[model samples]
Target: MHPGRLEGRYVAVVGPADDARDVDLARAEAVGRALAEEGAVLLTGGHHGVMRAAARGATAAGGVSIGLLPGSDRAAGSPEHTHLLPTGLGELRNGLLVRAADAVGAVGCSWGTLSEIALARRTGVPLVLLDPWDLPADAGVVAADAPAAVRAVVGLLAGR
Candidate 1:
């Protein structure tokens, strides 16, 4: 469970942090569970909404969950996070998450999620969109359903 080891595949689950829809949360949870089943470590924003749900799903599946918190207070992170990183960088920490991940799966749409997607594409990290933005095919973003997002990520990482 060493966050700095960089030995295992890391997947960042990016989405909104407040008042997320139940359907979106469910999809995020499924993505997290699927990533865990594939033995990929889960990373999230460590706040509420989709991030919390994804972390819970990963932990419930006996997988590691790491939180890159925007705030300085470690206690502000979701309870499901196994490792808390107090970045204190606000939304700018999104770049760190995108860079740390071998791949990224976005569960729902939001300004923050869009930023993450853009960062992933700009940084050459495989980006999987689950019920998120509809980017052009040439944008290098893979659009996938909740159940297929994990497979898409694995395939993308393998090809890279």
Candidate 2:
């Protein structure tokens, strides 16, 4: 709740890595790039699909991309992530991600993504949407694409 915590705060990116032909990976990439250029860290599930795409985009911009893994094992780490946070809580690692972020970018959503989005809202952080529907209004939802998500988060960081 402190001012400027979001200035360079981490953004939690929640999505499914099971789908190889997902429809929203592009949006995730755009969101990641935007966050990176703004100098914010990107946090993810540490695998493929949306997570890998976002990590790649962020790392390409020279920003840090971190993966929070379940069960304390990182053998499946996405190559783009520079750090891995192994919580050993399996799916419950979602809580750690929600705790670490100043905001949330809910993209390529699935059952797991929905859980993360809901938890983030419960935590009272801002949220940007790429999957668009089924999110809480209390989350300060950003309705635009990835670029807009980044802009919204940056504005929040600036206290605008």
Candidate 3:
């Protein structure tokens, strides 16, 4: 989408961009789709695996999706991203992912995803988990189902 049309409203979606083979990627993608269906923007690492799937879900739902690339070169972007942000900071790129988003959503449990969850929690951003094994004691635990998680998060976003 045109960059001008997408601004102010953004939701940073953080998850494992490297676990496409080991885990069920469809679940993560479904979570992303749920986010998009709710009309919030989607954000991610902007590459393969979870990021790509999430981007696809958002786009399929007609929601804006942005990718915060970890490298300076633009070749790292996934096909589903609506906007590309190239940051040559490698793993440090997680910081940008966490900060740029108004709220954060986590799907899989991997190292990168864990870091993102930590960052989001530390930043005091609203967060939702699709299959969270562990989370803050006071986190509003939504149902494990994708639709329920989406509804819960959207309600949180809407202050419901």
Q: Best lDDT goes to which candidate? A: 1
Instruction: Residues 52-158, candidate 1: write the lDDT tens digits.
Output: 99998989988889999999999999999889999999989999999999988888789898899889988888888877767767555555577778778877887
Each candidate structure's TM-score, on Cα atoms with residue i matched to residue i, is 0.90, 0.87, 0.84
Q: Residue 144, candidate 2: how far off, in angstroms?
A: 2.8
Scanning candidate 3 in windows of ten residues, the lowest lDDT window is 1-10
Candidate 3: lDDT of 89? 90
Candidate 1: residue 104 lDDT (0-100): 89
Each model's lDDT comes to: 0.84, 0.77, 0.74
Candidate 1: C-alpha lDDT? 0.84
Better of 2 and 3 by lDDT: 2
- Scored against the true structure, residue 92 in model 2 reaches a CA lDDT of 91
- Model 1 RMSD to the real structure? 3.7
Give the winner by TM-score.
1
TM-score of candidate 3 versus the correct structure, residues matched by position: 0.84
In angstroms, how far off is 130's CA in candidate 1?
Answer: 0.7
lDDT (Cα) of model 2:
0.77
In candidate 2, what are the lDDT values of residues 1-160, reduced to their tens digit? Answer: 2433344688877777786345577778777777787778899988788888889888987788999988667877788888877778888988888888888888857778887887877777777776555555665565567777777777765662
